[model samples]
Target: MNHPIAQRVPGRRPAAARRPGRRPAPRPAARRLAPLALLCALASLATGCGIRATSVPVDAGAAPSRVGCVLPEDRERPDGDGADSIVRLYLVCGSRVSPVEREVRMPDGRSATERLPVARELLEELQRQPGAMEDTAGFETAVPNDLKVSGSRDGDPDEALRLNRSLDALPPFALAQLVCTLADTAAADADEGVVLGGPADDEAAGPLRRYECDTALRTHPEAAETAGTDV
Candidate 1:
């Protein structure tokens, strides 16, 4: 019995020499969420470090509407001589344009037929050399004293007035003065604008063209420079 007692097993490790059990693998959802958790942590760190993004205020709708500057209303004097009505005349003052009030004796009639005479008188006033007061105030007019206006039946729309010279012959500033003056008078008659043609005596002249006095033309006479030779 002692002889056959025991033969030690060769090439076998002891129980204490065996490897320890391994930990379980992480779940699929947890593995997928790791990157997301890392991103959230980075964002929080950035915020904590006081980093900020830039932003701009934007106007998301149509722009605000603009209203043009208007001339003062005319003053009415019913009993002050024959010159009882006051009208605004656009005149050049230094580098800018402005309205100058003038008293004109309007005829008793309130018909459109009276517009032509009133327009003529206004033109005369414009052509007259700036008065002492106007000269002192740095006001001036570009209209020529010899320039004349007449009525025409040229069949052009709203074109009832004819100039003494070709529209192209007049300087832009001069033309603006004439156009605005006539337009102001015609407006009183409910006319949209003053339609003007070249000299009535010139048979080769072109047909009439309509002109209006807008805020741009009144406040900025230099705007007429690009109106072309036909204006």
Candidate 2:
């Protein structure tokens, strides 16, 4: 017996037959764009930040350090070891002035401690180069070697010391060193700081200016010239 063929529906097409191993039809535009939208969103997020994307690590230099400004125990002499002969000189350390002790012969056999000799000795010590221990402890001298000190001129105060150079000629740090060193020593009058003047020339003598080594001066020696007091 012969089988009858199926009749075609009017206004409707027959569905295409799918072959084995064949890919299905492409999805709708909306569905196909979902993956692309996700990728675009990820790319936008990566670029949204102001910083640039980098895989390589950057090298920053070592961290900064501060000077301790301290001396070793052996470097500091004991008080029992002839404390009278010990002289304290202010040295520059970490942009400020600090004291360093030194021992010197105090003019043997002299019954009286004169201001001129003691002042000269201390000034010379201030100009001298720092020792190895001092160097390691960040101590340095700012006083110029050629700077000289002499007795006061006529009509000047008995306690005044005249320098070969004028106050303005000296660097701030150097002046601070001298002022602090002298003011802290016996060369200075009791509670009067130190009186200093320039050499007397044919034109005229430079006026005397008194300097004090206060806590502010020790903290900021760069402004030393402004710390002078009226004679």
What TM-score quantifies how close candidate 2 is to the native fold?
Answer: 0.68
Find the 10 residues in a row with the least total lDDT in model 2.
104-113
Per-prediction TM-score to the true structure, in the order listed: 0.57, 0.68
RMSD of each: 12.8, 8.7
lDDT of 2: 0.80
Best prediction by TM-score? 2
Off by over 4 Å in 1: 1-83, 157-159, 187-191, 225-231
Predicted candidate 2 versus true structure: per-residue lDDT over 98-175, tens digit per residue: 988887755443222577787888889889999988888899988999999988878877788888888878889999
Q: For every model in order, what is the number of clashing pairs?
A: 0, 0
lDDT per residue, candidate 1, 1-231, as tens digits? 357745556888766676779577767998899998877768877574344544877768998753322332443423445656776676777555566677776655545777667778778878877665556566788888898887765454343677888877776678777777766564232555666678877877775666667877776777665442232
